[model samples]
Target: MEAFEVIQPGPLTTIQDLGRYGYQQYGVPPSGALDDYAFRTSNLLVGNEEGAASLEITLFGCQLRVLQDTTVAVTGADLAAALNGSPIPGWETVPVRRGDVLSFPRLKSGCRAYLSVVGGINVPMVMGSRATYTKAGIGGLEGRALRKGDILRAAAARPVTGRARVPTAHLPAYDDQVELRVILGPQDDCFTEDGIHTFLQSDYTISIQADRMGYRLEGPRIPHRAKADIISDGIPLGAVQVPGDGRPIVLLADRQTTGGYTKIATVISVDIPDLAQTKPGDRVRFRQVSGDEAVTALREYERKIQTVKNSSA
Candidate 1:
């Protein structure tokens, strides 16, 4: 089978599509790309379907040797990637030949990166998705991160000549501090007005406890009007759940199926990628927006993605 040989699987690298859906009722977490913009862009650049399987590299990156001629595109974080020892620009489609080695020396910005080939990663679909949910040891390449010598097959049988490039205006800029828009939530009334003020006004530093499951923020305590306990409720993506200790945790793709803590707000869908790119020690600020505003923002985001897809096509 035509595939790329894993030479050095960096800190964390896994195959992921959009996500595993419709199985959440069975307690399955939606395991997908942290940065939706980058994931979709990478696929578009390589002429693959927007939800095609791609590699999500975290903090660091890996090295891979092409076993066949193929077209590839790297998106999300700038990992200072190189092809055959020469620096190769990301966010643009590039061709690789058999035996060509790709490496990422260091991270320049952002927390994760996505690598996509013309044909998506040809991993077997589990629950209708090739996404990897590492916690349960399901999906992806062997239901885990890739290891040295592992082979990743591509869906495309032959190399493609697609030459897509993401516009600079569409690219995201990463920083140590990010502002995430939120919608005051189902449990907002549980928090005191002062607590809501503190949450909206204060800067919460991303704690080391941050992971794919959630981002624990360390900052001023958010006082509750009563108690911080809630009947275990369905945890939504980007749910800002606050525990008894008063710290807020913004849930992400791998968040638990249910959470008992009171959720004060939900990070807007459009800003989830910005939060996902944040690393430990980074600062986060929340801004409250009306539900209508959030819906408009999401629609705008969808239009932006559609524009890129149209251009690529």
Candidate 2:
């Protein structure tokens, strides 16, 4: 049955999940929620499977009406959400009866928030995912942002038989100044020592020009050693490339499959969620780590997710 109708289109709302994997050969970039940890946690809280399609709302003002009874949970940014005029707590699943109204006031902290339902959004899957890649016009409801008066359908989910809650300890804290972990990259040697030091030592502010493709940081311009352009090679997510301008750009989910720009480092997957929540003018610093250390941190984060799932069970 249908879930809700968009009464007001937020700043940027799109359907997303873990993302489409193993499709880069077809020139498809894996498009998914920017804050994956929060997205997955929100889905789990509502008893939805991992990688379920959830609405990713960016810095506020979204309104929707529930057309059917549903269980939903919000995670990531504290958007000051309310259901039927009553404030709803973030990181907890709440039941929404038919005809209930859901509204988001504004972003209290963090840039994006995820709203996950029990069964997930019922949208046609493209390349095995319901993620909305607006640039390519694929996935989601007509592959676009939710507009006013747009009705959204949701898969039929079993009634809530048990309470599944995300433990308070597992919830990430929102901070205006975020420290992101990175691993020195494929083109680390191409940058001067001073440039590399600047990236680690100086604080950069997130620019207002951020989007799904990449997040631009406004800081000391980092210059490259060689002036010649390099051949475009496969670029990974979190690649922090310093183009001709010297400003670092951290490529996100919908980034191009390959690029020729010199990359200083890559943000570890575990910390990308923190990067996603950073807004314009938010201060951020990067710390370099060894590959082994990065892997260990990722494993630890996965263990925490598993612990939460077991506790809920």
Candidate 3:
């Protein structure tokens, strides 16, 4: 196995894959890459499988030196990555030779970036996943963020002819303002008619108090008709919980297995990748859709991804 030693772990960096599903019964949240689409795309660009473990760098990424030749691709946020002091473009796979130093600058657009290598990061798997769940303190570099002088092993080197290239037309355009599609939730009736209208029409700004657990939005306070505290129930990804204070919190990958707050709506899975890229103060809107429509949209997105993979093959 080849490895890369971390010189400096800028901000936050962790190893992640598609995520750990089927363990929610054990009270474990499916912790994984925040932007699954970007993560998968990066892995594919490096000729890795869709679920290969990759580095999920937040805000700014780390400085690392390769101990062996490798193919790598960066996706998601434009973190101004550089190799050996030379600029590296996002969405394109590149060859990184031994002793080459890679650095990620401050984010220019999105908040996080995914760095995928040819054979994926080689780390001990817990609960059948390489994803780091910082809350429970499991997986990835001893269940925590990568640090200075840490050497991360990569999976055994496979014969690589050259770097895989991603067509420019296949890349996703980063947008600051995003309109997320929502499905009227299990607790939609708990909100007042006016509150629902306000939620649909108002533009909410992403609050600074955000993490993998949830993205708190700052906007009109939506008052619930019933002030009663509900019993805790299973909360899925993208569940928009409205606490008594009225601010909406959109749950994400590291969200709790269950929540007691009233949910106004649930953002569809197809739009979550866009939501994952939003930074503090980014404006966001929500549009309600039927459950069937939401499912259709997700299927369409998946189909497009398959089409791209087939075309490349």
Candidate 4:
């Protein structure tokens, strides 16, 4: 059934699910929601499966005309969303009716937002997923950012909704400065000890070059022991690649399958959501942690997510 009609497509709104996975061997990138926490939370709020297809709105927001009464939940960056001129609540299920308009007129904090419907977006699955990897022109609605006049549809018409709201204590903060935890790498040996020290000590500002592929950091040069090249190994999510330029780029979901740059460290998976919500010009500092600590932190993060899911029910 039809959901909303796009009046304005905002800056970079795209349809996405968890991501198209298990195809990296063929050089395919995992393009999906940057803030998985918010993405999953929005789906849960609307009573949809956590991995169900949804919309990822970036920076500026969009305008959608409701074609039917449906339940939706917006999470992630606070974009000052509204329903027919009334302020829309974040992290909670909101029932919208036909002819009503949903819009995000202002960016209050953070960089991205997730909008999930009860039955999920009715986009065809590609590579077992409905994520929009615009660069590949695969998945989503024709595999691109949303355009005006586009009519969004849902898998089923489900307007009846549960009162699902994320507790304030569990809500992630959207701050300009965030400290990301990292595990020193598979290639930390390539850098001088002082280089690793600089990485952990320095505050890097996110440059305009930031995107789903990776965040290019502009800060102190991380000195290498010798050269900064490797034999083009698989690039994991959150891989901190430092090229000869000495600057670091934190690779993310849409990162290339393989790269030759030496990866000094990897950001723990759970911290990806926090990194995803940051805007350009934000300050990022890294803290080194042991593999055991990383694992423990991940388990704790999952526990928090399960709590949210339980409350959603």
Candidate 5:
């Protein structure tokens, strides 16, 4: 069986797929790749299924030794990657042979990167997904991040004819500033009109407290109509919740199943990748959009993904 041995587990490396489903009722978080576009497209570049498991490398990258011959692709944030002392480009498929050492030395831009091999990471699935929820220690390899000396196996490697590359236009730009379109929330009425205006107009800086769970932005405090508390409700990905401190925390893939904070808005699906790629100091601004517009934007993104998949096929 083909496998990889972790030489250096940089920062936080973990296996992730589309995420665990139908289990949030049990307080389980859908701990999938933060950057979905990178995760999905990287798998495609390596000729793997859309939901194939890949390594979500955070902040920094890791060093791995190929135990068997296979092909791999690196996408999302460009952590300066090199293969056995030679510089190698990311965002494209690269062939590897047994004993080749892949290392990510620097994090040039973006916060996370996806490393996809020809065969998906063959980790045991929990609740129908292989995503790693570190908090609960469920799914993925022992439900935790990759560690040094850990050996990872792939399901099966498929034949490849040539290198596959994602076009520049299809790639995401990890600029210092990102604007995410949001839909006014299920609890938007809890906030005053000025609060909504502040949320849409003011700029927020991603705080160091930001993590897979949620991004705690530091900016103007958004005033609530009465209190910031809410009868604990189900939380969704990209939920913009404000607590007593009035600071907005945008929940992410690993967010708690429910939150007591009032959710003023929800980021549209199309802007998730951009939000996910932001680092601690990145600037974020929100724009309001109608529910209908949000649906149209999502459809457009899906259409692009399908087009890429079809072309590659």
Candidate 6:
């Protein structure tokens, strides 16, 4: 059904779900929401599945006009969202009417926000996913960021719904600095002991060159034992690769399928959402954890998500 009409397509608004999976071997990078936690929560609030496509708004919010009555939820960053000139809250569901204007006026926190409707933003799914990979011009409304005058259609959803909320304590916290947990391995031996210590102890700032692909950090160069190059190998999400210059690049959802740089550590999956919310100039520190600890954290994270999913919406 007809859903939203774009009045203003902010800076980098795009459609994303969980991501395009199992196609990495084909060199297709998984392009999805940077903040998957927010993305999933937004969907749950609107009675949609976790992977349902939604609008991922970057930095500032966009202006979208509702074309039908629908329950909508906005999650992640607080953008000072307003519905028809009245303030509306985030992390909860709100009923929007036909011709109602949903607009974002200011960015108060985080790097991105997700807007999910009763069904979901219905773009033809490519590669088993509705994610937009702009670099290759593949999924999502023409495979690019949302454009003005774009008419977004929504998938059909079932009846029987009310309001849902993610408790304030459950919401993600944002600050100037965030500590990301990592499991050093796979290529950690390539770096000297001092390099590992620097990576785990020192503070690094997100460089101006941050994007969906990766984040280049600027800080003390991590001392490599000899070289930083490696045989071309598959690069996983959140892989922290140290290049010849010693700067580390934290690969993200849109990272290349294969790379030659030596990866020093990998940010844990549960913590990647925190990393995704970081903006340029944010300070980051890494903490090393054991494989078992990382697995336990992931299990706990999934449990929390399931708990929220079971709530009455």
Q: Candidate 5 lDDT, tens digit per residue, 1-313?
A: 7579999999999999999889999998888988888899888887899889999998775999999988899989988888998988877888889999999889899989899998799988889999999998988899999999999999976656688888767877799899999999889999999999999999999999989999999999999999888889899999999998889999999999997989999999889999999999899999999999999988988877776576552
Deviation from native of the Cα of residue 33 in model 2, angstroms: 0.8
Q: Which digits, one per residue and each the tens of the lDDT, describe model 6 over residues 126-167?
A: 999999999999899999999999999998876436678887
Which structure among the candidates has the greatest lDDT? 4
The per-model lDDT (C-alpha) reads 0.90, 0.88, 0.87, 0.91, 0.90, 0.90
Return model 6's CA RMSD, one decimal. Answer: 1.1
Q: Which stretches of candidate 4 lie over 4 Å from their true place?
A: none
User: Which one wins by lDDT: 4 or 6?
Assistant: 4
TM-score of 4: 0.98
Greater-lDDT candidate between 5 and 6 = 6
lDDT of 2 at 219: 93
TM-score of each: 0.97, 0.97, 0.96, 0.98, 0.98, 0.98
**Per-candidate RMSD, Å:** 1.1, 1.2, 1.4, 0.9, 1.1, 1.1
Candidate 3 residue 304 Cα shift, in angstroms, is: 2.7
Please give, for residues 1-313, the per-residue lDDT of candidate 1 as tens digits.
5669999999889999899999989999988998899999899887888999999988775999999888899988888989999999888888998999999879899889899987899989899889999989889998998999999998854456657788777888989899999999979999999999999999999999888889999999999999899888899999999999999999999889887899999998899999888899999999999999999998988888887787773
Clashing pairs in 6: none
